[model samples]
Target: MPKLTFNIFPKEAHHGDESVWSNLIGGPSSFSLESRIFHSISICLMGISCFYIPYNLYAGLYVASFSAFIFGIFFFHQYYNSRFNARKHNNTVFGLIGLLIFGVNYFANSGIHGSTDLIWPAYLLLVFAITPYRQHLKWLTGYLVFFIIVHGLEFYYPELVKYPFLEGEGQFVDRISTFPIPLVVVYITIKFIRQSYDREKKAAEERAIAVEISKQQILIQKQQLEDSNSEKNKLMSIMSHDLRTPLINIQSYLELLNASEVDDEERPVLERALLTSTNNAVEMLSSLLHWSKSQLEGPSVHLAEINLLRSLQVTLDMETAHAAKKEIIVSYQIPADIIVKADLDMLQLVVRNLIANAVKFTPKGGLIHVIGEVLAQECKITVTDNGSGIPVDKQDKIFSIKAEPAIG
Candidate 1:
């Protein structure tokens, strides 16, 4: 535990075929799955022949011994070419060799009652595993015909058949020894197939998860874009109406003065009105500049120490003048020593909007009161007026980009 535990299987969750185990069986990244299977089975066959060669020799079955030796050499050569040189084993050569050797072994052994018949099916299975799908029908049909012709020859000419096994004991030994060949072939082939299937399933699942995450990110980006567009539209609407109306008021006042339409008491009244419009226009223009800057270079918060009463007094004074036009009484209650950390422009914008809203909603002769108070560690500001209140159904979800800005 202290030192090392080598990861023989590095990419287990969703690994490619370039693992160490994969490379040992077949050339990694270069070989197909079928080629890997071919190499694996060839290696197993080579080992099986090592046992068979000696066993056949001891049993005095020289032809069987020779066949086993040949099988070992053929497979060893194939394994070397495939695993070491990264060469594809010749399927056609391998299939033809199997047919020739087995045909000879059938007659040399006890024809129709020998282990050659037992090994035939396993060999055919190996051929199909290694070869392409299109060649399957060709090999199967050819093997079937060969098998039929051999048995038919034995039926017609009994003298041509060899009886190499002396009795039950001899036949039993041959069958038992030959049993391992098919068993090993089936075991390795099925195991490799199952492993390949599991790897594919795991890779598909990971791809699905990645796709889902990408889809979620796209959805979040879409929501953010929609919110930004809505904010842009709101700013444009405010600038067109608020800033333009005040400038138009100043223009009209100048026109009236130039025409000699205002005189004495009326001139003072017109000057006061003109001053109010100019101030409102300047404030609106300043807010518009901040909005434009934020649009050009994304919104950023700048928090600083602010003298709360002193900063908001200007906004309150402006609101009071607007309220006087409607005969609505406007007043405020704020501690002079109340200092805060906040963005000055944003703080003033929110307060001004709130006071303006209250002035708009309050009836003639109504009282609009602005109050600033300390609540524990935080500061709270409220603009209240004797006006029609929000409905219970509408109060829970009050603010939205789609909702009207003013309600009276």
Candidate 2:
């Protein structure tokens, strides 16, 4: 089934509430909604007056005819002003004109005994709708005071008033004709109020839902952090207990071998044991430290303009000296002015690690090349060496922490 949506007023009027009464005080900054209401009411009054002017003329009521015609002109003028020259249509002045027109009709038509009394309250309601919220109490008081005074004057001097309709169908027609003004006024006022209430209620509900969702996300993140810390602590305990003893044993044997002379065969075994243990300890510690830092402090990247060539040159110089011991050739092709956006220390660390690995894997007298180039928006750095790379089967795991460390 197709969904059904009910809207009392057009979507434009509902959304443009601020503009509905442009001259009203104490409303939202935009007057689109209020302006819409002003235009709509003006059209309604114009239509009503059009009918009444012809009816009054046919009935030979020149006074009523002239008044209805004037009302028609006033409504047309206001409609145009609100539609185009909105700034010129002062809200309070327009409201007073409506009140004055209705008040005059009250006395001129039948004084306190006419249909004007029936339309007076609704006209005031219309005034309240178009006026600013802050001015509502004042308008209400003024209307009520004026109403009482009119009734008081009529009560005191009944001879001073005139009755427009005779007792019969003419009076009935006048009452029936004036009925729509109040009816339309009340309907529009109630619908506008209801629409505003619904919009505010819906907005509040959405805000509450958003706040709850944020709270849930925060709770989930907090739980994940707790689990990560628990796992890291357990891993730390295992590494400290299991690895430390063997590492210490290797170090003690190296110290002992250094302190005394040993047979060639025993010395090689001790050196090999110390070397294996040292490599394993270094790799394990590196993985553990990286994991712990990430879990506890999170990753932080500080970006700055870095001289890529200078950073790579430094790494190459350090690695080249180490390579020189094995009679390896280390060459670099780096432009001096090549710059990139990166964290200086992080970039240097990464380059040093890559070059050091290349030096370790390359055979004696092999060439190692460190090159950098600017490719579009990125700076590409390459480290190459004439060394046997990782085995095809282990290639995928080379960057993983669990990958076994290999020595040249």
Alpha-carbon lDDT, every model: 0.79, 0.70
Q: Which of the numbered candidates is closest to the native, going by highest lDDT?
A: 1
Tens digits of per-residue lDDT for model 1, 251-317: 8777776776567878888888778778766876787678666854667778999999988876776
lDDT by residue (tens digit), candidate 2, 265-376: 7988878766765665565456546644654565467689978886555445545655665788988898999889997656765676677677778888988888889899
| Native-to-model Cα distance after best TM-score fit, residue 107 in candidate 2, in Å | 2.5
Every model: Cα RMSD to truth: 6.1, 15.3
Candidate 1 versus truth, CA RMSD in Å, comes to 6.1
Question: Candidate 1 — what's its lDDT?
Answer: 0.79
* Candidate 2 lDDT score at position 222: 99
Residue 136 local lDDT, model 1: 99
| Model 1: lDDT of residue 9 | 62
